[model samples]
Target: MPKWTAADVPNQDGRTAVITGANTGIGFEAAKVLAARGATVVLGVRDTAKGSAAAAQIVAASPGADVRVQRLDLTSLDSIRAAADAIRADFASIDLLINNAGVMYTPKQTTADGFELQFGTNHLGHFALTGLLLDMLLPVPDSRVVTISSVGHRMQAAIHFDDLNWEKSYSRVGAYGQSKLANLMFTYELQRRLSGKGKTIAVAAHPGGSRTDLMRNSPLAFRLAYKVIGRLITQAPSEGALPTLRAATDPNVLGGQYYGPSGLGESRGAPVLVKSSAQSHDVAIQRRLWTASEELTGVKFPV
Candidate 1:
């Protein structure tokens, strides 16, 4: 059991990967590495212009790298459907799907589909995308789905099945925490369902504290706090991307494994096998969340 690093990522030739929010931050770094390693990387983003620019950057960095950009607004089901349809039409199969797009603390809002913004974009959007793409995923042996969660999940209360939308009471931090927790729960349960199938693996990773634009839309106080304190805590976006890269490419990684920074408080270091909170491992809650997610998204796992 050697600790893994980017060097451990085997050559990814002939593989295809779709990474959400690859236009910037940890997603961008991960995409760049995977494409450089010879995987066909699709940048799933809302802004075509930015996505194109990011793809260009990757191609420039890794000459002859096969990379493209696709439109995907996680906040909208229509966008998710369109992206899936386009990918299915163009590619024979997909090797990896990284649910890496996310939003941090922000003022209360709603997605295009009317769910709370954080939960909708961060958790439900990826949930729907993963479900919709299950057919393609299942047919590809060794395929993987990696969900990105966070340590903030430990600070928040458990999922409020009664009011998942935060209709009763809303708090930005709490919503973000809940959404992150949902990501881990989704990852573990997906692994449980896919167990013994031998076709696909579901895993989760977190960047710890990364200096990315994910917090750009945060409220003033939050922004100021990061401005003053981020230097002491956060790692660079490239450094932050290690856990995701490890999960995506490490051959030794097991299904349902969660990876994160190995430094103090899991904030910054080489990617390492990390433990999720006790609540995140509760099967009953994960099952309920899975059912609720399927019902809410109107998309069932094809497994």
Candidate 2:
């Protein structure tokens, strides 16, 4: 089948979407397109000012776009809970939840909940937020959850069962790779659990190398390298968002089906169904990760 583009996404007249990190980069682009297509978009972001600005920009670009801003700091459990509560109080249902917020290579730092930064924000935070919003998601027929992983996931050596939090040792790139891998594992496991419960919400998608502010938080050396060499390798943020939009809105998409770019090395192009590494499908590891996540976040899936 041919790769899909944003234009291929069906009309989303009455649907509602919540996009994490919608203040900038690929998430911002995705939110803009969804709102333009008539979906009510809730921008879940860390910075209230930036989120409002992004919403304003989208509304300006697409007049009549139903875009609103909500503060969400994924690294903080208290913030996550508060954001989820606010959404619950305002919306009856959420048709799409895009786990698009993430952290890249950075010096070792812990979240407010003491989790290693990348894994905490990138995986565990979303895991908790999704679980908290399960009631809202379950009522909407054909609702979907799109977890954004990365091509860098392939670099993950293993689950690091003994050191999931990197307490023993930490390498910024390795930790980031592991977190992305965790995203894929979480996506698949979520599909599995939802399927067993007869839920129809599909879960999938991964952006290939995209030039975005995700690099801005990186170490100085990494940021410089990305600034110089990234231009030649990474696609624009708008292009990077296509796979996510396709995953969220494509009627043909099925649960657990991953998508990414079709260009050489899965770096740039329209969104196409892509294969994940064998390690990504390890059920035992996924189960362990899920358990660990629940313990870490103090949030459990109702399944």
Model 2 spans > 4 angstroms off: 1-3, 196-198, 217-228
Model 2: lDDT equals: 0.89
Off by over 4 Å in 1: 1-3, 219-221
Backbone collision count in every prediction?
0, 0
TM-score of 2: 0.96
lDDT of 2 by residue, 97-160 (tens): 9999998887899999888999899999999999999868876778899999998788754678
Q: Where's the lowest-lDDT run of ten residues in candidate 2? A: 196-205
How high is the lDDT of residue 68 in model 1?
92
lDDT of 1: 0.92
Q: What's model 1's TM-score?
A: 0.97
Clashing pairs in 1: none
The numbered model that scores best in lDDT is 1
What lDDT score goes with residue 207 in model 1? 98
Candidate 1 per-residue lDDT, tens place, 1-303, comes to 566667778899999999999999999999999998999999999999999999999999999999999999999999998998999899988999999999988788999989999999999999999998877878787899999999988977589999999999988889999999999999999999999765899999999999898888777887899889888889999899999999988888899999999989999888999999999999999999999988888888877
Report RMSD for candidate 1: 1.3
